[model samples]
Target: MSTPYEVEHGVTAGQTGRRPQNRRVDMESFFSFLHQISTDAISSVSSETTPQTHNNRHAEATPVDTANLFRLLQDQFATLRQTSPDATNRDFLEALIQEVDRDIADLPRLHGVGQEFLDGLDRVSKKEILKGKKGEEKCPICAVKFNEDPHPLVVALPCHTSHCFDLECVAPWLQSKGTCPMCRKNFVRKKEEKKELKEDSEEEEEFDNMNGVWLATGYPQTVIAIRGVDEKGLALVRNGVEVL
Candidate 1:
């Protein structure tokens, strides 16, 4: 009888499974090339203008500006796609090219999750993801079956249970839009809103503390007055009256 394949929990693809050395090498090289392209693109952009200046220009950016940025990113990916021996890398580059086009579609309103949010995304193992009774699951971006890849590093968005995607496929999308591709849910913005609410609550509490204000139970009408004295041993007064 064939031995039952055993996979661990919360581990990446190549960490445990029968992943080939060539596939591992391909993965590493693909990501490294992508990183280089990103660095070059960002460096080129920085040479022309700072981030703040770029953002300001985006509001009034002409077609030429958009085209130049698009060309800069697209040309890099095209070159990578040409030199890459692996079909998977070419597929990823194709998807990324689409993302670049979409991003340039609306430069002024383009927003995405930052590196902090991306790093904080939850990674899940193949066993952790509950598959459907249907056919093989494929990545929405590259349309490649997850099972086909020997080392599929999948990430789960906080949006839903079934909202899982290949890390490589989803990273570019999240970095471009900060929303789930399947659900269109903006988890990053939701998180920021919750944080803002908590901050506002803290600010209100601090303001109350500074003013010596307290909520008294069953004494809504009770008046607890506060008076402040200056360094001169005199009441700090305002508008010709003693400040309470």
Candidate 2:
């Protein structure tokens, strides 16, 4: 019988669990551990789906195994919750566990934002967040006071000026829902709309480059709907006969 951590990662739990309780976890090491966990989960998913990838190599590879990745994240958070001495840390971890659990449950309906959108979100500085605020402002998702952390990474959503959130708390939600959790404003649709507009503009530019100059310079420029199209692909009638 293997422990959950051992089952998740082939390595024995003792090797990874050597961190002393009293030692402070550096930001880099903390995130690195999360990165490793997410990587292992993705590898596990890749192994399971190897046959599918082998069958259709042309298909785009999934970046992350959302279900497995969230599950692993939940497990880690739960473990941390168990061991955390501070009530605040425990509470935060518990909230994180629930968030991951909800993501796992809602896997079928989730259409999350890609890394590009997450990276492009407007960073809200502490000075900006504190400006003109008399009382403590809480993050909409975690409901934790913004000032609780000496330095909180806050982000502003495109939906509205007031729609701000703690980057740490809202990141997973955005990745899962691709919407403003407080206002339910859809970011995924906005991204798609922007993409469609860009493509349309590109196509229009290509068409204009190929035909616009020639038509403007060569023909009399009488634009009309015609059954016959000219060699230059223009629908122009010249002297009672459609130019072919």
Which portions of model 1 miss their true places by more than 4 Å?
1-105, 129-135, 211-242
Which model scores highest in lDDT?
2
TM-score of 1: 0.49
The segments of candidate 2 whose C-alpha lies over 4 angstroms from its true place after superposition are 1-64, 70-110, 211-244
Q: In model 1, which residue pairs have backbone atoms overlapping below 3 Å?
A: none
TM-scores of the candidates in the order shown: 0.49, 0.50
Q: C-alpha displacement of 59 in model 1, angstroms? A: 16
**Candidate 2 residue pairs in clash (backbone atoms < 3 Å):** none
Global lDDT scores for all candidate models? 0.51, 0.53
